[model samples]
Target: MKRMLLMGIALLCISCQGIAQEKKEEKKQFPITKTDAEWKAELTNMQYYVLRRAGTERAFSSELLENKDKGTYVCAACETPLFKSKHKFRSGTGWPSFDREIKGNVAFDVDYNIGYARTEEHCATCGGHLGHVFDDGPKKTTGKRHCINGAALKFVPENE
Candidate 1:
C-alpha cells in the first residue's frame, strides 16, 4: 500500500510540473498594453511612419536595422520587447531581419495588399504593424525573414 501511495505522489508531482510549464508559456505569449495616441506621441515622425503607418524604411537607411549588436529589440511604439540579437541575421535585403521573436512578444497577420501573400508582423500590445516575414531567408536555420522596418524597433544594447 505504501508503494502504491508513493507512485501516486510521483504522478501528482509530474502533473503539477506540467501545469507550471504551461503557465510559463502562457505568460510569454500574451501581449503588452498601450494606446495608439500614446505611441504616436512617444515615437518620432519616422517611427510613426513605419510602425503605425506600415511604412518601410529606406534601404540601408537605419543604424539599428543593420546593427549586429548583442541586445534585444523592442517596439519603438510601446517599448514592448520583441526579438533577441541572437535571432537577427544579415539578410542583405537592406533591412533588419530576425529568424524568430523573443517568445510571446509579437503578433502576425496576413497581408495581401500588394496582391501577394505575405506575413505582416505587429506589436501585440498595441496592434501596431511592423513589417513582413518571408521564408527565403538563411539556409542554415529557420528560413524566416522578419523583414522589419527600422522605425518600428528600438535596439536595447546588452550590458555585457
Candidate 2:
C-alpha cells in the first residue's frame, strides 16, 4: 500500500512539470498586435509568408541581398528599424546577412522546426518572424550572422 501511494505522488509531480512546460509556450505580447486579416491586407504575399507565417523564402531570391546602399532595414510588418547598413555583409549564404541587429528592435526565440534548435529572430514591435541568427559569422566582427529574409524587411535610405 505504501508503494502504491508513493507511485501516485511521483506521477502527480511529473504531471505538474508537464503543465509548467506548456505554460512556457503561452502567446507572448508584443507592442503592436493586429488581426490576421489586417496583416494580409497590409503586407504583400511574400512579406505575409515570411513575416506572418514564419515561412522561408527561396535562397538567392531576394533583391535586397545585393543592395549596397546605406539604409536601415525595417520590419515589413511594423516599420521598426532592425539592422543598420554598416552591419550588413556579404555572407554569400544567398540571404541578406547582418553582423548584428539594431538592438532593442529585435527579439529572439528558440525554434526546433527541423528537429534541431535554432535561434529565431522576430520584430520586437509586432512579433513578425524575421529569420535565424547563427554564431558562424565574420571573426572580425560580432561573429554572429543574422540570416534575415528580405521579404520581412523594408529598406529606408538614411537621407529618407
Candidate 3:
C-alpha cells in the first residue's frame, strides 16, 4: 500500500510538470494567422505603413508612448509578443523604448546601406522590420536602446 501511494504521487508530479511545459510551448506560438491580403484588409493604411513598410511614427504621436498597460507589446504585423510592459521606461526620447526584447521573439540584422553601420531589429516570425537599436540608452539596464519605431508595436493590456 505504501509503495503504491508513493508511485501515484510521483506520477502526479511528473504529469503536472509535463502539462506545465506544454502550456509554455503553446504560449510560444504567435497569435494571429492571416494572409497578406487579409492583414491588409484588417489594418489601416497608416498601420500597414508602419508595420509592413518599416515607416517610423511621427515624433510624440504614437499612442503606445502614452499607454500604461500591464501586458506584453506584440508585433503589429505578426502578433508576436516582443516587449513586456516591465521593460518600458520613460526615456524622454519621444518614443516608447525598451531595454530588451522577449527572448527568441526578434531577430537583428546588420544594416550598413545608409552610410552608417547599425543593427536593424525585425520580427523573427513574420520578418517585419521594426527599427534600429543603439548603444546610447540608459546605463541602468543593458545600455542598449532598442529604439523601435512606435508604429511597429501594439500594446495588449493584461486581462483582469
Candidate 4:
C-alpha cells in the first residue's frame, strides 16, 4: 500500500511539473530586445517616448500623413516591415493610417488608458508601441484602421 501511495504522489508531481513547463512555454519572447539605455540611445526622444512609453503624437504633426509615395513603413525601433503604402489611407485623424499590417509582423493587445478598452497595436519583433487600431476605415478593404504614430515608423521608399 505504501508503494502504491508513493507512485501516486510521484505521478501527481510529474503532472504538476508538466503544467509548469507548459505555462513557461506559453510566454512569448520577442526577437529583438534592447536594454532601456540602448533603446534610448538608438531612438529619438519622440520615438522613445511614443514607442517605449506609449505616448501619443500630436495630430496633424506627422509628415507621413502627407506622404503619397510608394513605400513600406517599418518599425522605427527594429526596422521590421509593418505596413505597405498601398494599405495607407487618409483617415483624417491627422496620423498615418493603414488598412492592414504585414501578416505576422504586428501584435495586438487591449489598452484602457482612457477608461475604455481599445485595441492597441505593436511591433511584433521589438514589442514597440505602434498605435491603436479602430474599425472606422474604408469598407472596401480589411476594415481595420491601424492608426499609427509617425514617430514609431520609418518609411522606406519602394525604389530603395
Please give the CA lDDT of all the candidate structures: 0.80, 0.94, 0.78, 0.93
- Which segments of model 2 are wrong by more than 4 Å? 1-24
Model 3 residue runs over 4 Å out of place are: 1-39
Ranking by TM-score: 2, 4, 1, 3
Q: How accurate is candidate 4 locally (lDDT)?
A: 0.93
Clashes of 3: 0
Q: After superposition, how far is residue 80 of candidate 4 from its true place, in Å?
A: 0.2
> Clashes per prediction?
1, 0, 0, 0
lDDT of 3 by residue, 93-160 (tens): 88888888998988887756587779989888876667778888879888977877677888888882
Per-residue lDDT tens digits for candidate 4, residues 1-160, read 9999999999998777544234233444789988899999999999999999989999999878899999999999999999999999999899999999999999998777897889999899999999999999989998889999999999999999
User: TM-scores, in order shown?
Assistant: 0.74, 0.86, 0.71, 0.82
Better of 3 and 4 by TM-score: 4
Higher TM-score: candidate 2 or 4?
A: 2
Residue pairs with backbone atoms closer than 3 Å in model 3 (clashes): none
For candidate 3, report its TM-score: 0.71
| Cα lDDT for residue 138, candidate 1 | 81
lDDT of 1 by residue, 55-126 (tens): 888988888866888998988877788889999988888888899887676788776679766888888876
- lDDT rank order: 2, 4, 1, 3
Model 4, residue 113: displacement in angstroms?
0.8
